[model samples]
Each structure stands twice: as structure tokens, then as C-alpha cells.
Target: MILKDALPQGRITGTGSLRTVVQTVFDVLARFRQYMTHPGNSRFEPLFEIAMQKQLYNLLLEWLSGETTNSPDKVETTAVVASWGIFGAAVQWSRDPLHSTSEMMVHRVSEVAAAALAPVLGE
Candidate 1:
């Protein structure tokens, strides 16, 4: 459901599709946070994290590829960078001392991601 509904096909730029993708990634992470709150308890944490990030990357890739104008190579690269950026910020949000809300995190990540992917997701 996450990837399938990530973005509308074609004309995604400047139409809030990017925000949808970012929100989906955060929503998935928020669900995972329930099970992964304590990373220190597991020995396979590093492997688990890599797998999770890969899933997020694919989610963004699905959205990027929805637009026919994006080249295959560029879609993969942008997805990789944006996924990492989103996941990295999510990790920080989890570790924050003030414990900001997920809504705030989603909004902040959306802004940063839109800027980061402007070349491909924007005009």
C-alpha cells in the first residue's frame, strides 16, 4: 500500500506528491519504532537498519519512477540519497532529548527532502 499509493503517475512535481512519499516513509518508521526502540538489545541491529533503509529507498524510488520524465539512473540515485536523508533524520528524531512529535519530524523532513530532490522532483 505504501509504494502503490506513494504518488500520482506523472505531473508529480510541485503537486505535493513528494510530501506524500515523505509522510509514508515516516509513517512506516513510526511503526517500526515500536519494535526497535531499544537498538542496544539486539546484536543484528546494524543489519536490520540497513534492510529497513533499503525498504525506504525503494519506497522513494517507486514514487520517483512514477513520473515518466525521470531517467532510470537518476531515479535510483535520488531515491538513495533522499531515503538516507529521511532515515537519518528519523534516527535523530528518535534520539532527540526534547522528544519532538512525529508531525514536526514529518514536516521538517518533507521540506528538506523537497529541496534536496528539486532537480528531479521540481521544475
Candidate 2:
């Protein structure tokens, strides 16, 4: 679905902040793509493992088949697959007792996203 159509339609009339939200989501997706595609980046292996454990890989197949129930159709199945890898990585790391895996993973994703978007943001 287009970003405008991704917004809540009942209580929300206009697109409001959803446009920005979708833009940010797309920017993050780009950064994630770069990270996953790079050969030197060691993050993908662990993330892929997590995705397997979480069954996100299978969900992605279903998503591609247009058999999902809740996700937005316009987001694209490949996008969901990539995002699931990132999210699964976060969950896997968060299981560590010594670190706040969730916070660290979020920080990592945000850092990559900000750097990737820096030129686009003109800073």
C-alpha cells in the first residue's frame, strides 16, 4: 500500500505523520539492505539465523504469496523479509544477560539509518 493508505483511516482523516513515518521506514530499509548485502559485514549470519528460528523466512514466503492477514500489502514482501531479519537479530541479541540487546540493536539500526540518510538529509 502507498504510504498514505498505510495510515489509520477511521479516527485519522489526513495522512498526518504517517507520510514521515513511511519515509523513515523506507530509509531504514535502504540502510538495512546495504548492511545485509555487504560481504564484509558479519551481522547478516546471526541475523539470518535468528530469522530462521523465528520462522520469518517462512512468513516471507507467505507474504510473497499474498496470504498474510495483518501486514500492509504495499510494503512489499522483500521489505518484510529484510525487516524481519533486522528484528530477529534484535531479539536474538537481547537474550544476552549482560547487555540490553534490544536497545543496542535499535541503536545500531538507527546509526546505520542516520548515516545512510545523512546525505539525503543534507547533513
What value of lDDT does candidate 1 attain over all alpha carbons? 0.71
All candidates: TM-score: 0.68, 0.28
lDDT of 2 by residue, 1-123 (tens): 232243454111222332232233343434455566678775665664454434433332333334334344433444354445444544445444145533445556545533433332234
Backbone Cα, N, C clashes tallied per candidate: 0, 1
Question: Tens digit of lDDT per residue, candidate 1, span 18-40?
Answer: 67766666666566566666766
The C-alpha RMSD of each candidate to the native structure, in angstroms, is 3.9, 13.5
Displacement of residue 2 (Cα, Å) in model 2 is 22
Output the number of the lDDT-best candidate.
1
CA lDDT, every prediction?
A: 0.71, 0.41
Off by over 4 Å in 1: 1-21, 27-40, 97-99
lDDT of 2: 0.41
User: C-alpha displacement of 42 in model 1, angstroms?
Assistant: 2.4
